[model samples]
Each structure stands twice: as structure tokens, then as C-alpha cells.
Target chain A: MSGQLLVFVICGAFAVLGALGLLFFHKAVHAALSLALVMINLAAIYAALDAALLAMAQVIVYTGAILMLFLFVIMLVGIDRRESHRELIPGQGVVAILAGIGTLGLLVFAILGSFPAQAVGLEAANGGNVESLAALIFGSYVFAFEFISALMIIAPIGAMVLAQQARLTAKKTQRERAAARIEAYAQKGVHPGTLPNSGVTALQDSIAVPGLLPAGRISTSSVSQAMVDRDAVVNVHAVSLLTAQRFAELSGEVPPAIIKPEPVDLVDTKDERELLK
Target chain B: MNPEMVALLAAVLFVLGAVGVLIRRNALVIFMCVELMLNSANLLLVSFAYAHGSLDGQVAAFFVMVVAAAEVVVGLSIIVSVYRSRRTTSVDAPDLLKL
Candidate 1:
């Protein structure tokens, strides 16, 4: 076998394996990494085919930029491993297998019917891979090329607009947030210690407070604070129930008073208070 | 390498991508499978260009790559936005259009 053939077989095997890995990996991060592997191997195949410019572009655009973007989104969204495994659409797996086989059979039949068996290797165009691509893009397909550029620009802007939180949920300014925090403290008859010169509050306080300040005997904020302080071992099941109740309250739904565990002593230690200071 | 063998490889890869797209529930994974299918098509185009002794195939492949990049930007943004609202990446979760 020629060197090119050997490389093709190896890269082709890698591509198939990577694609399979991408499909089956349980974690989104792992799947993203597998896709990157497949893309890099595909770039290698492009190079083997003497499409140098395409190979470089594939590496830079697909593997480098696009795959990285995928990883960023996966990380930003927080990887949730407990995804529902139930098929949302009934019989999707069986249909997919059948469709795959049908597509393969159709492609093979078409190739056999019309593809010429003997053909020459690609000729070097007017200049080379990059130059010829530029010529064709600029000369013959310039309008389409310009349209794609416009599309590229519009896509990011649209994505930003789509991904942005609704105007109602727009983040409050530091002063507004501080004021809200102070108001929450006042309602609870607790003195919010000296306000920080800067806007952001302590991490513990922020985590302890729910977005909606609820006045109640069993507060989710107190539970979370106890969890943080390691003062109480709140039952995991109970914590989840409390969280659901809190969510309901935040959504303006009537929250049911579930099992209220004995309130753990708040860690209002002098040392801890000083630490907050 | 025999052009026929290369073409066969591309066809198989394309099939795998199609199967993946059909089977995977994760929107991001499905998008990646679409990219795989696009890559396979690019491979076939380059192979045919080589066989025909023409540059047009490679040029076409280049255009496909560019379009794929643009598609990724738009598609991923939409996916991210959907995830932001629903907190789930499962393609089947969003059934706004389900009759």
C-alpha cells in the first residue's frame, strides 16, 4: 500500500471512532472533546488529499474556534450529568437506524450508477489551492461570499440578543442590589453589618439569601447558611423539598409548608461576625 | 489511494453522521453530527475534484467550510439561548411547535 493509502486508512479509522465517541459519551464535555478529535483527524485527511488551504482552514475554524466555543458553552451552562435518558420521541432509535441504512444505500447506488471509475488527479488551478479558492470565491461566487460575511456578522449579534436575559431580569446596579439587601435585612429585624464600600456583599450572605426575600419560620436562606456553616446536617431530601418550596414562592405560587426540620442554631459566632467584618 | 475507496469512506462517514443526528437527543451533539456530515461531503467534493482534474471541487469545499462556520455561530447561539431559558440541552425538550 502507498503512504497516502496507509495514512487514509488510519485517519479514517480515527474519524469513525471519534464520531462514535461523540455520539455515545455520557458527558457533554467528553462529547465535545470527541468532536474535536474527529475534526482534527478530518483536517489531516484534507491535507492528505492535497487540499492544503482547506486543511488549515479546517484546523483553525472547526477544531480550534468552533469546538472551543462548544467547550465554553458546555462549561458556562454547568454540565448536568443526570440527563433524562427516556426517549422523548417514541421509536426514534429504530427510525434513525433505518434512515441511516437508507441514506447509505442511496449514496452507494448513486455512486455506482454515475461515478467514473477512472479519472485523473486534481490539476493545480490558476495558482494553487488558496489562490484558486480566492479567485472562485471572489470572481464567480462573490455575491454569495458577501452574503455569508453579512451572515457571519449577523449571527453573533442575534445570538447575543437571544442569549441575553429578559429586560425585566436585567442585573441591578451595585447600589440597587445593596439597597435591596438592606431592605431584606430590615424586614427580618436583623442589622445588616456596615455596608461594604464596594457594592458586592460577602459570598456567604449572598448565598444565604434567596432572590425573593420571604418572611417565614422555615427559610431556605437559613438552611443554606447552615449548610455553609456546617452547623447542621440538613437531610438531602428535605433540602430539595425546601428548594422546591422556595422556587414556588419565588414564582408567586402558593408554597406548601413541607416537613420543617428542627432549626439548627445559626452560626452567629462573634469570630464569624468579625470575619464578615 | 483509490478514489473509489476514498469516496466510499466519505459515504460511510456521512452515514454515521446522519445516524448520529437522528439518534442523539442533545442539541449540541446533533449539531456536531451535522458538522460531521458537512465534512464528509467536503471530502467527497475534493475527491471528485481530484478525479476530474479540476479545481472547482476544492473551491466548492472551501465555500462549504465557510458556510458551516457561519452555521455554527447561528446554531450554537440558538442552542445556548434555549439552554438559558429551559436549562436543558435535550433537543426534544423544546416542543413549542409540537402539534
Candidate 2:
């Protein structure tokens, strides 16, 4: 029954009660304000515990960055307030009630288990200062510290991408993707020079189509079949014209001509022998 | 546990605040819960200060107040801005929440 123990009991009660009130409250602003109360009280609690540096950080970092971020977001989103606009998830109330009860149980168990044990004063030992904690955090938790930096980078970028301003670029990207698909197909040598209204060419392709022809299109199908039958006449004409032009260029003999593409050697990074093994 | 009471209590308050944030749909409420958790730990530190009979705790607590005041100023302004963007004040309706 020490004076400090008594102080802890009183402050702890206030904190627990404040937290519960914050949870049960309906209005968000009120909750935030109450949470502020919790912050101040916590600082006081830390001061009582002889850890001055930690107390300040609690107020500065926790009260500063985290809460401000919350408020900023709250103001930005502008949710509908009318009861009609409330989109309550199914079983939410049930879950909330269960959570509240479970929280109460845990607090009670902790208090009971902790009862009668005299909470001693650790004034003799150093309550790891900023320097010591920073040493450990930077040394042992270097990865985690770096990870937080990465998170900071990623979170804002992610937020910006979803924002309304970015919607313009998003639409542009979609258009680019569609155009890319069309370009990719065209690059694969699919009738790049053909006119848009090349009905005869399309009809010719239909004859080679492997699937069923549509019903009531017997006339078109017959026309395509006739074109296929006239294939020898078309081929002979085209081949004769090409050969005549070549013969003229060669002055009748058409001396042997050859065109070759140079071979290219590319550097490979993989270990070929290891891969073979 | 006694020497670590502030740490333990700070941890508790912080956790409770987190729970408040998770359970409550109201943005303001969650924010307040977070502030509460911060202060709860602050109180533990103050108690430690008194226990150690040192003025460092007092100095830290003073700085914490300054930070808290600054936080309120900045936080409230941000909230005002957010309110303008979004008409409602519920956490569930945050624009970034949709999966």
C-alpha cells in the first residue's frame, strides 16, 4: 500500500474508464477529444513511473503524428451522416458487444492476478533513455526501422494512386493498354496494310475458317467457295507478273542472287554449366 | 512488474486505444482513443518520475504537453480539412478503406 501504488490505481482507473467511454461514444469528435484526455493522463502516468523520455515520446509521436493523421483523414472522407445512409454490416452489434465483454474480462483477470503483489519502485535502475533505446532500435531492429521507412514511402504513394486526381491518368493508362494490345496484334503481321472496308478480303478469309458458317448465309458461303475454286487463276496471274518483273531486272538470265541476315551474339548472365548440372 | 509498471501500463493503454480504434466506427472516437492511449502511458512515465524523485520526468512531461498542444492544433486543422472533403465522420467510410 505505497503512495505510488495508490497513484497508479487512481490513474489506471481513469485510463480504463476513459478508453471505454471513447469506444462506446457515438460521435467521432467526442471520441477524439476523450482520447486526448487519455494522452495527457498517460503522460502523467509515465512521469509517475520515472521515465521522462518515454512520456514525452508518448505525447509527441503518438499524440502528434498518429492522431493528426486520423483527424486529417476523417475530415477528408466526408461520410454520410443520416440514419438512412448508415450501412451497418451484418452482425456488427453482436461483435461489438462480444468485444466489449471480452475486454472487460481481460481487465478483470489482469487486476485480480496483479492484486496483492507490491509494485516496487525501479528508481535505482535506469529506465532506458532515448540514447539506449535508439541504440537497440537502430542496431538490432535496423531492418524494422528501414521497413517503417519503406512503409512511409509506400503508404503515401498508394494513397495518391487512389485519389481522385489520379483518376485521369488511370483512364489514360487503360486506353494505352487497349492501344498496346491492338499494336501487338498488328505487329504480328496481321493485314497491316488492309483497308478498313476490305469486305472481299474478309470474305476470302471466311472460306478458310475452321468453324461453322452462320445460318441463312448460304449465298455468301457459295460466293466464297467460288472464289476458292478460282484460286488457280489468281495464283497463276500473280506469279507470272512477279516473274516477268524479275526477268526484266536480270536482263533475261536472272543471275543467282542471295540475301543473308548477319548473325548476332548475345551475352548470357546465367551459368550454363551449373544450369546443365 | 513494479519497475515496469509504466511500461506495462503504457502498453495496456496503447493496446486499448488500438482496440478502441478497431472497434469504433467513428473517426473522432478512434482518434480520441488513440490520444487516450498515449496519455495513459504518459501518466505511467510521470508516476515513474515521482518514484525516482527526479525532475527529468517533469521536464519530459512538460515537453509532452507542448507536443500535445501542437498535436491538437495540427490535428484539429486536419480534421477540419477532412470534414470538408468528406461530409460524414465514420471510420468505416474512409475513402481508402475499400479493398
Best by DockQ: 1
lDDT of 2 by residue, A47-86 (tens): 4565556667666766666666665554455322322225
Worst 10-residue lDDT window for candidate 1 chain B reads B1-10
Residue A170 in candidate 1, Cα distance off native in Å:
7.2
Candidate 2's iRMSD: 7.5
lDDT of 2 at A11: 71
| Clash number for each model | 0, 47
The C-alpha stretches of model 1 lying farther than 4 A from their native spots are A123-127, A168-277, B97-99
**Where does candidate 1 chain A have its weakest 10-residue lDDT segment?**
A195-204
Docking class of 1: medium
TM-score, chain A, candidate 2: 0.47
Best by lDDT: 1
lDDT of each: 0.73, 0.51
